[model samples]
Target: MISDEELMALMRYVDGECTDEEATAIRAQLAHDPAYRRAYNEVRQADEALAALPLLEPSTGFNFRVLNQLKAEPHKAVSPISLRKRLLHISGIAIFLLVLPSVLLLLSSGQNPVLILDGSWLPAVGDRQAQVALGPYLQPLLFVNGLLTLLLFDRGVLQPWFRQRHQPPA
Candidate 1:
């Protein structure tokens, strides 16, 4: 049986890939060894068959269509860092808006409005003192603003991005 190295050398000889010295050695082997001759003929036949295969031409405007498709896509998915940055931006805006009123109030009145349960400033429900304070509103405002920001990001950014990524090409 012929060794793997002999077979490889035969293939390289058939493909015209061997150096002058290697080609001389393989030619000597092919003349003397029937196995080398057979392997060389097989490799030569396969190479001819592969070369004879018709080259397929793509449809017209293939490059244009591919480029247009790539340009149309905005993003495959939102990265975690970008999402974090977006959330931070929304929160910063909300926090600024929330704090602005209080800052303005403090500046206008020059009085720190503490969490007071005085019913006099609030709408009277009964004899009980209603809770009238910025401290109470702060938590609820933060919660609502954060929730709205997240919802908006999901709807406007994430949902569309995921849909585009998953949708089959036309």
Candidate 2:
């Protein structure tokens, strides 16, 4: 299919509305591109046909027939959301809002949340050398842990809950 831009250019070329440079470019395209040429011909034919068509007047009963058809269809009542579902949605939003602020406040307070790790299974970082060596990797380790937690949370809880909530009743 020819793109809208190409179609517009062809239409303008057909209508003698394009500049000389644009018309030349379009003419080159029409000569070299079979698809573009076909599209241009189709547009030109449609425009000519529309111009040749006489102005049409609707029949005297057209409005009456349309109104009668509209009246024949039964009206549908929109069902309000159930109270339980509404409450569930509201609670989810409320929890998110509350926890977001608490998390932001804690992070902004500049107090480092301490982690107590059991490193007894691993080789001891004797003296201060190994600890210093591992210090650079601590941030990356924390970042990976946070990313994994979020992925697991999304897969296990968020996705299931969302699917259940949005799925239509069978």
Candidate 3:
């Protein structure tokens, strides 16, 4: 069987890319070796067949049609701020607002003796004084606020930061 280097040399010679010395060596081999001669003839025949085929030309309106098609298609615009990110920011702000009132009520509860003395500040519930005080609900509210704060930090801050770090550069 003919080697890859011999075949490549034959191709280069057929394409008129070989030096005089290389072409001389290949010509000598082709004359002496039947396999080399056959391979060389096959390569020459294929090149000649390809060269004989007519070259194709595009229509006169090809460029205009392509440009018109490109213009007809709508290009999607990428927004700088995504809807999900906006919603996350707005929700984080709202959660912060909710947490503020609970925090203030909890903190001011100890200092404000007048509010504690008068349960009348809380509206009555159907002929009975509303036994429900801010004291009991404050701890649970703070707990929920802590959870929301953690959620906000994770979704709004850590997730986006991590995604940005791991993304493949454009």
**Highest TM-score against the true fold, candidate:** 3
Q: TM-scores of the models, in the given order?
A: 0.37, 0.33, 0.38
Q: How badly does each model clash, as a count of residue pairs?
A: 0, 0, 0
Question: How far off is residue 57 in model 1, in Å?
Answer: 1.7
Candidate 2, 30-76: lDDT as tens digits? 88999998898899999999999999988869977887777454554
Per-residue lDDT of 2 in model 3: 95
Error of 1 at 77 (Å): 29
What TM-score does structure 2 among the candidates reach?
A: 0.33
Which candidate tops lDDT? 3
Off by over 4 Å in 1: 69-170
At residue 164, candidate 3 shows an lDDT of 72
All models: lDDT? 0.72, 0.69, 0.77
Cα shift from native, residue 55, model 2 (Å): 2.8
| lDDT for each residue of candidate 3 in 1-170, tens digit (9 for 90 to 100) | 79999999999999999999999999899889998899999999999999999998778699778876764544546466665775777687687787778677766768422223444555663334433356666667777877887787787777877987997654
Question: Any residue pairs clashing in model 3, and if so which?
Answer: none
